[model samples]
Target: MKRASLLPAGIPIGIASLAAFATAMIGGTITDLGPWYDSLIKPDFTPPRPVFPIAWTTIFALCAIAGVSAWRAAKDSRTSDTVIGLFALNGFLNILWSLMFFRMQRPDWAFWELCVLWCSIAVLIVYCGRLSRLAGLLLLPYIGWVTVAGALNWEIVRLNAPFG
Candidate 1:
């Protein structure tokens, strides 16, 4: 068995890498943790700020790898399309959460959007898992991070209400 056969109909790994990294870049750009964010009341469990970039970098890298694996593992074009679409949607939702919470300074609205973002991740697990178990398993950390994010968002909303 040769590895070449696996990628016969697959997309270039760079495309997957670009898609994944682009999401991170966009989201990072939208996030502004300046004085406004500093004034907010965060939960006692808030990890050191450094934890964020490290985790996101690792997650996006995993997502890129998983994207390629899922693409190549797809046995049919339909499966391939579905896999790509799911990843794309997840990226959009990921960015949207950043825009809502940090840029808009509305953790309240962001919390609602995060719920939708969470659902997208769950869907990715199902679809990506069916295409490639490795791809699906790789997303577990993403969901975990989002769960932590959800808790943070909820706490932010609770601690700082009456946003203008």
Candidate 2:
């Protein structure tokens, strides 16, 4: 009986998990902490290289859970679609920032783009939280992580400027 009851939850969880996986894979592939990155003068506060994968993996997992909560709590298809759309937008912005900062070697541009990414995460927290408390609470860590990333990015920009 419990197994049958959980089927509805299984669907959304599976979908959200897949979406999270895709986002992480795509973003991780494009983010290159290569020679250019090594050449930059990072702050002493900068997280060690290993910290990034662990942090991002944990964040994506939580986001998947949050996405499931929001999807299930939504009252209408439109509401569910909206939540999914916002996540998609956030995912795109997330990947783009990596591409800009690491792959393109443009932390300056990445810094500006990070503002929009932060906004997307903020909107996700408010909008998803309205739909489901668990969803909103789950996203709290995401915002915090992004805040730390933003500070790191700001410091990188300050330390390394005039990039072509």
Candidate 3:
């Protein structure tokens, strides 16, 4: 038996990539780096400021690849639609976290939202795993990053609470 292409011809991986890029860009734009953010008391383990963009860029790229792979691998249109819906939901949660924490300057609220984000990642991993193991594997790093991010969000809230 022959293996199918990871991304079928005319499957529009470009569109998926573009959507992921847009999501990342929107999240980045919402993340403010001004006096308020600088004033927050971060934990010792917090990565250097420059590390964030690089890390997020890589993660988003992997997410796009995983999404396309899973979509292509889906055995039926219902499965493909499910993959698309899950990815769309994850993207929404991803951007919402940035808005909650950075734009609103409320790490407390962000911490709660990150819980939902983490769950979305886990769901993607599980569903994508059923479709394509490689796709699921690709999402591992994303969950790891989100784990670290959740920890950081919690610490920030702990260190600087009572937001206005």
Clashing pairs counted in every model: 0, 0, 0
lDDT of 1 by residue, 44-121 (tens): 999999999999999999888888888778777777788889889989999999998888888899999999999999
Residue-by-residue lDDT tens digits, candidate 3, 135-154:
99999999999999999999
- Which parts of model 2 are misplaced by more than 4 Å? 1-7
The lowest-lDDT stretch of 10 consecutive residues in candidate 3 is: 1-10
Candidate 3 whole-model C-alpha lDDT, 0 to 1: 0.91
Q: Is candidate 1 or candidate 3 better by lDDT?
A: 3
Clashes of 1: 0
Instruction: Kindly list the per-residue Cα lDDT of model 2 for residues 1-164, writing each as its tens digit.
Output: 22223556478788888999999998888987778788999989998889989999999999999887887778777887798899999999999998999889999999999999999999999999999999999999899999999999999988888887
lDDT of each: 0.88, 0.89, 0.91
Residue 35 CA error for candidate 1 (Å)?
A: 0.5
CA shift at 104, candidate 2, in angstroms?
Answer: 0.9
User: Roughly what TM-score does model 1 have, to 2 decimal places?
Assistant: 0.92
